[model samples]
Target: MPLVAPVTVHKISGETLTEVPDLLAVEEPLEIRLGFGPITDRQQRSVSVTMRTPGHDEELAIGFLFSESIVQKPTDIISCRHCVQDSQKEGNVLRVELHPDVVMDWSRLERNTFTSSSCGLCGKTTIDAVMALTPGPLSADFSIEPAVLHALPERVRQTQRAFAYTGGIHAAALFDVDGKLLLVREDIGRHNALDKLIGAAFWQNWLPLSQFGVFLSGRIGVELVQKSWRAGVPMLAAVGAPSSLAVQMAKEAQMTLAGFVRDNRFNLYSEPDRVIIGQVMAFKA
Candidate 1:
């Protein structure tokens, strides 16, 4: 069976019962373990246990490592493997092996009880926690026209295939200099979707996403800003509003943050200089 599927349920409300079809959200536990070289020098460390949809476990692991600063280059990772003792047991745990010299600082990650599809960022204690680990934003002189920002939400909406069917997944897409869609990834968790996109980019040998722009399907939160900065994305656009702290982080990173992008309109929260607003207006006029 595939990881996700749709089901119908009947509910009664005051003698009126109707069968409604709804998309089921898959929740599964995945434990990530890190192994560092040698049988005698082998040190196994448990990193994070994230509950995510089952597919793309390797991408999730690599994305986690990249976002956490555990590994810089792809060569830092020696190999990735998954093991399941029994199919009945939730045992698809992933183990990643990093180069012997790769240093890991586990202090940056917060211990969360359960990271669900919808509430991936809710477990965060404060913005300061994310800021401490988040690298400074891209210091590039890149700029995007407001017209390009206005056109993105519709383009992104059209690209989300899973969302078209389920309407329950989040998406993150990258666009090139000419505002062409480069890649997109959809997942139950917003952060995971972004991570999967970043992981895919890394797999394609496209690191430092400063030359491109990232468009998200939801609001820009602290976690979203942190992940974008870590990926070196110069500009981030969202279909919903951005948190105050997210704007602050964008300012610190010198990234252009725009939100509420819908219907040819958007709110530029920070670093307006990175947006060619006048050019868009001139073009419109």
Candidate 2:
């Protein structure tokens, strides 16, 4: 399906109102189902239904599962494809078949009831519940220069095809230490965008993304930080501010967190050493 659709809107400026053609980002529901158990007795479960821009559906499903700790590695998945219902391809429904040997966790599927484009942890009972899933403090081995950090948002913006037309989509991108853009994903949801990026990296066996940093097109939420930390990303920077819990989570995980990363400046909330600055700066965290 197309990521954007055509629309007509009134252009109101001063006393003049003219109808002009415009584009809007497409938003649709994607149901992610999981197929697990032995070959003799297979079972399926509807895991998540999220509203997202219609593209890269498979990546989004895999990324969601991985970030939530449902599936560990790419090999754990036997196949991932859209489902066929009523003798027709159901574009909105996707199924991820897991390897038979992988033990299925029935409890994990309960927390994710329905995910929206704007929020990721809508169903979690507590912050500690999500915090327990972290793999521990990330490695402090990665580092990038301040100049390189300042240039990432624009670089991500340059490649955002959907955002260019609709101006309503969110994006997530991965970059190397020298400020090289490796991968980018766009969606109506900030969390889905990051999920797609992580899904792509996971397919390429790039977990434990210790040498790279993730950049977001929006605010850095605790969920986004958790997703990045799960992928082993050492640093995460966003164009907007980070919530208090997000900062605390990053500090606890020892991951670098930066916010307000635009117009040639950014604020480092934690693990400031990852961003190379000439002088020592004191931070309470």
Q: Count the backbone clashes (under 3 Å) in each candidate.
A: 1, 0
lDDT of each: 0.77, 0.87
Clashes of 1: 1
TM-scores for all candidates: the values are 0.84, 0.92
After TM-score superposition, what is the CA distance of residue 67 in candidate 1 from its true location, in Å?
0.9
lDDT of 2 by residue, 166-263 (tens): 89999999999899999999999999999999999999998889999999999987788878888999999999999887888788789999999999
lDDT of 2: 0.87
Pairs in clash, predicted candidate 2: none
Best by lDDT: 2
Q: What CA root-mean-square deviation does each model show from the true structure?
A: 4.5, 3.1
How much lDDT does candidate 1 score? 0.77
Q: Which parts of model 2 have CA positions greater than 4 angstroms off?
A: 86-89, 111-127, 280-285
Model 1 spans > 4 angstroms off: 1-3, 11-16, 20-22, 37-39, 89-91, 108-137, 279-285
